[model samples]
Target: MAQTLQEILLAPNRRPKVVEDVTKLVDSEVSDKSGVSGLAVKSGYALIKKINSSFVSDAVDSMLDNFVGRMEPYYASYKASGTGSFTEHLTANSSDVADALLGVTDDRAAGSRRDSVKKVYAKLRPQAKKHVEEALPRLGALVEEHAAAVNTG
Candidate 1:
């Protein structure tokens, strides 16, 4: 029988590892300059690429904050069930993880912060979707590995 996404998500022992690996992979792939540049070019804002890159990076960080925040309760519930390492790791490195996920490097333009905020509103969803899609395959594989281990052991 195939496990559902919810089943995978709620699996106490496996979920943390799966989430950690998936998030890392997504962060690495989405934050790649080549990938962001491609997206900026597609947006027809290639000339303002630096600004757009900062906006995308900030947007992704915000998105990860929301995502990780939502997962906090789950983390708490599983805290004694072997998720302590992940919980501690997340607590210690969330900012770094967010930065990695966002791919932020240079500071946003001081004067254009307001404009970048406005642009990020328009770009957040699509960029989040792209990152999620990029991470899906690896996430699936992790889940499968967990399921296989559970079944055999």
Candidate 2:
């Protein structure tokens, strides 16, 4: 009608139907330790910020080349435009083409893609020096900024 444990701390004689209990002594202090999930959340946020920065920097890296490549035709248009139909007259007669190409117009509305591009060119002095020293620009080998940096590190 009863059983006995191999209780090292108790005697078998009267270890009662409702036996004595053992309890732990808690210090009642809260730990300042953080969990793995919190760390993961922080790291995930950090990674998102890093990814966003790189996306913009990748854009900045191409800013000069792409912008000049775009505006070049307009600058070339003054040379290229003669006079003719709607499209032809549009390129020649529009004052905004020169103004926009020179970064004097609604570039602010375009978020200063023009200024950002100009800064890219302004920052190229060192690379320009290196190419001039290396290539010794001849007649036909005139260095376009876009073509100059090609195949370089």
Quantify all predictions' global Cα lDDT against the true fold.
Answer: 0.46, 0.30
> What lDDT tens digits, residue by residue, belong to model 2 across residues 18-120?
1211100000100111355334333433453464544333432334233334344543553355443323433343444334333421242246444543343
Tens digits of per-residue lDDT for model 1, 13-109: 6555655665555445545525554566345333344555554444434343344444444344444456434434444444444444333211322
Checking candidate 1 for backbone clashes, the offending pairs are none
148: Cα error in model 2, Å: 22
Least lDDT summed over 10 consecutive residues: which range in candidate 2? 22-31
**What TM-scores do the predictions have?**
0.38, 0.19
